[model samples]
Target: MQRWERRLSDAAHALTNCGETYFEPDLFRRNVNQFLTIIRTVTFLIAKDKANIPDYEKWLSSAIGKYWSGDEVMLWAKESRNYIEKEGDLELFSSLSVALVYSYFTENDASIEIGRSELLSGGIKKLMRLAEAELPHGVSAAAAVKIERRWVANTLPNYELLQSMIYVYSRYRQACADLAEYLGIILSTTIPTAESIGEGEVHQRRVSYVKFSDKASYSKLTHRVEIDRTITPPIWLKDVDRTRPNFEVYAEMAERTFLHFGNHLAMVFVFSENGTILQHLAFTPFDQVDKFIFWRDLAERILYLRAESLIFVSESWVRKDPGLLTPIAQAEILGEMLHVHEIKRTGEVSHKAWDIERVGDQVSLAINDNDSLEASGFPNYLVPIREAFTRIHKR
Candidate 1:
């Protein structure tokens, strides 16, 4: 077995054994059913026209039958439903489902290989095109409602419709994987120790690269880039009293240092010497409000753009409010940047600054730095940020 396969198998074994302690039989069945569903969906998408799909479905049904109607599946489904209702995020449910499906494929190489073959089949492409055609175009909200009404009047939950949706979603997931791979490559090249940072630190220092494109004045468009990084102080520094002469002097020193280099992306490397990166996040730019809306509906579009190599840095000011997702103002700027970058591929990198809440009363500020690098078809520029923590007492 390949290394990835072995890792997946080990994970499955661990999960199975753990389930055995609390509720063995039911949990086992539910897991098995989930695996079967993934295989069924992937294999079904592989067939050229639906000729061989029935056989695959039959096999999946049998496999699922062994686990379906089990208490574990019911319990998990209930929990999933509760999460969906509480969060009011359909994307969460879709993400969970996709993760489960991918887990199954990871465990079985033969099944995934077959599914890959089917995915590349011409029949699947035609099905994708048909589904795309069904989606509404530029029209008034009332007109869209009318179109949806007409669609619902004729549409039925038939096997063909289900199959087509599965195909499209599967393609989308594949595209995400491709984008991740490309980004990984670029990060590797640009950031020397991109993969060396531990996962824990990476999570703590999560930074997002949001790209923006312009809809109006497409010819004069440009890229808006932003960088978000986490910062923590050293233990010794934290131990010192905030009012102490040395402590106050050092605090001001650090703030000044941070602000002085805030506009420079190159400063991250220098800062890394003092701390670590928790996460490196990046996404493609959106062209307009409608495009942003579409992306919100299909989270996979972020991956699609990455795969196409149409990504740029977003300006810092656009992400001033850290909690919000895809701010409208930022989207507009990003759209313009995306448009301009597409044409020229080089320009002055814009920078901005913002602050993030830290563990105590102290706050950490980050400067959004920007740089335009030639596309090397890989993620060579992603430097993994390191985390540094310090404790500070109120004086």
Candidate 2:
């Protein structure tokens, strides 16, 4: 690869992998310095090649005046490289702590912003609380903890390490493009913009599951119903024709899907007559409003797609006092079936299912609540767990 090509590849690789080793301070520091070195090398190579120009000094002054002089980020990038090479690893202060959970189901028992030094000293176990932002609402406690870390350099405290590196990399890459364009030389590869490579924090979110004593029951709580979004289109669907519909084949596929996701939370699969999946929506939302919007949109999409058969399965929280699922806005849809299972905090389960069908161009909702209640006891750990986490957070 050419110099510009190699730099782009390295920067892209660095940004993509930075999150993997972000918490390891030494590895992170070395990565940061290596990225800074890329900036320096790019600058040095551009300056060295100026000897080829007839009025090299004039061009150099013009380029600096145009790109570097006024840009604080570019100026910082230049100085940061020099500083790190002479002064050892970049000075970084990092901390990993749990961001407190706030949801409709759980009360905000703890409301404290942990200081950086304290958070670092506390460690993952010490900072774990009753719940986390990533966990769905209504579980007695968080099944997974979201451990957040921010790496800030001593010199640049305002912006975290990832953001600072992105800005620096972007500024230098732009300079390379501009210099090449000015010299009328065609580069080997297209330069990618910062946003395309990732402009924000290098590592976005990291979730680690907290093991509980009742492993089987807690597994159900943590198990989110989802179709792997990363999946490519299945080969079987490739031959299905949208113009000609086959409702029978589609219905079979929908039944298989229901069996797969029946135990978990939210899911909707809409299929056309020829067995092609028009849309498969499966996301577990923690907020009530988002859940409402998700179902409402599902209903709208079914109508829009003119789906032959659709399966909608959802899990809901039931109020122990009322023995009823908590009120959430519902959207009426003409579908094969709507199955809703409810779980109370105390580990009791009840269900209300409806057979939704189209009769003479009108939709009918026939409700059935004959399903037996499941008495699988919920783990008796909330009180002790909450107390333990509260004590940790306080300390």
Candidate 3:
């Protein structure tokens, strides 16, 4: 590897570390723009040489061309590179024209006028293919930098994790919104605690309560007194969790509501805070959640659910029953705390915020220097995430 190619490899390494920062796009973009400057140098250094292969030609046409070229895989790097320099993205290219672009760039089609002002998809693909085809020839320009295929080939393990997290996060936001609205209409109030309820009035109350684990038992509780002239039955509340002491408080309130209101009121609904207990509410039949459940370590469940909601509605793919996610949508986020991590070049993340702080949705990252995660949030998203670990994590 020559000095320049080696530099390019280092830059790509930095680019791969962008995974830890993916949760914060602006930071990722900032870091990418900086590292690309180093990598783009390979493009220029090779541009000056006229030999078996230039650095740009050699690097682009490497064995790992496909992974490096895919838009979804490297959108951040490519778009950031283009936008940083040109102040815009390279426009989508026509697939049909890929061959033409290839022929023009690598053949006799220079007669065709291709504008430098715009980048076409076909052109990019053609470039990648040309680079891939040229793999047989090394940079005859005397290893400007001793670079190898390894620099850009390997997939960042955590990169996939970030993608999955973002996938779930987006879904959770959408699903939670719809579920919140549903809860607003269905729930009489958000008060998890009331002033007080007495044993004598408990039977008189027109409301009934039951634990989630004991949902079947709710029907047995009958109103012992007809305190109201109308003498209606009570409303029923399905507290999301009965294991917690707080569950009793909610149950008593439901009983109080029933003692007052009677009949046509036994609607069993769970609060959003009990997200974990509401696992029964996870509705997606085909989803990443199940994969995590069966395959991954149990401790990572919180990481999955919090970063990507356990009951995520999953972006624009709307469900006919957002009600399926009611357990997560109702709770309000009270506050948040941010923690920064240092993602080493080896793809290992270490604690310690290299000066990362939440400036907006992103942090102040200099060179993918910090992998910051702002963890603390409202119990609605947290409850289920926490509960999942307790339920599934190996003891």
Candidate 4:
């Protein structure tokens, strides 16, 4: 219990500090169910004291949200559950607290952003209020002197209690995940923490869950499972088709994408079927071949996902093996260098299109007469043969 209590404190602190939040609508609602389950089981020792319970219970319902059916409180267990279950938001409000409820039913970008804000502060705070109100040591001190039917008071362990509580809460959280169906497909990736990155150590990890939803749900979900000492986690999945031209896909997507507009750090938005506007920083150039391959493979994996795919990757991980995923934008970033590598490796050039301008045995790039480039620029684009040369030879 102490472990859970401390974690609950940690969660509260994190929430207060981080103003933003995200919640899968389904996951939010199922938790509400768990909350209700707890409330229903809390029986009173005194019948007269039960009278005051109705007023507090009614306040609990209304305080959580006006969305709930604002009606009189009933003590009957079966009837209480039945009425709540019939309510809206996928019947999420019936079991879960109103604070945790976010108004998300349709699958879209705007809806998610709005719901996330609510979940972070309003939802979490409300949940805390509910817990404190019911518990004997709660902030409001709402629970009366009568013995609780649901909670049996006993002398708890004095030492090493927090460790056991943590284990219990983890299972409870896992159980919540097991019992409730997450609304959309989750695409996740673990990015490296700054200090350990590029130092040859997997010293830190952070996972991003890109929840995708269509008319229905996807069968498999890969989550970022965290542990005590491990810094890097795992990536979601991989892209099987390696033969496709990655840049052509980018070139063709010119109409749908822009470099500067919208969520500019748009690498995360690659999984959306609708094109994304990426930030320039997201295109950060990498000289290390492995890191370049990793970033490119992440793009490839998301490109292949038909359902909402949650991606997970770390500093130590490129989404797939170097050869398995095609590097699109990554290629463009080092197109000339890669072209040179290919020529050096195979003793021939695969791309017959790029007008080659060689500077003393090293080949540079001249833009082809492709319509996309001709329209976008002043034309006559030149790329260096090797970035290591530290020189740009212009004609």
Query: Could you say which candidate leads in lDDT?
Result: 2
Residues forming the 10-long window of minimal summed lDDT in candidate 2: 212-221
Per residue, candidate 4 scores C-alpha lDDT tens digits across 1-395 of 22222333333222222111112334433443343343333222112233433454553343222311321122222243445567522221111112211111111112111233234335434444554454333112211110000101022221111111222222233222221222132211221211111112110111111111111111112223244564532221122232444333432222122211211122222221122221111323232322222343333222112112221111111122223133322222322211111111111112222333446655444445452323433211011111101111110
lDDT of each: 0.26, 0.47, 0.30, 0.24
Per-residue C-alpha lDDT of model 3 across residues 1-395, encoded as one tens digit per residue = 43434444455444444443443545655554555455455445544442533353444454224223442434444444566687742222211122211110122222122244154334434444443455222211100100010112123222332332222222222232333343343211221111111112322221221212122212112222322557543335444345654334433443344333431121211223233221212222222222222222222333333221232111111123323223222334432222222121122322221222245454332222233233422322223334433432221
Candidate 3, superposed: residue stretches over 4 Å from native: 16-29, 40-76, 88-395
Q: In model 3, how large is the Cα lDDT of residue 79?
A: 47
Candidate 1 per-residue lDDT, tens place, 74-150, comes to 23433433544465322210000010010111221111111232332343233233323542222111011000000
Estimated TM-score per prediction?
0.20, 0.40, 0.21, 0.19
lDDT of 4: 0.24
Comparison by TM-score, 3 against 4, better one: 3
* Predicted structure 4: clash tally: 21
Which regions of candidate 2 fall more than 4 Å away from where they truly are?
1-17, 53-64, 70-72, 97-147, 190-193, 199-202, 206-395
Each candidate structure's count of clashing pairs: 45, 2, 31, 21
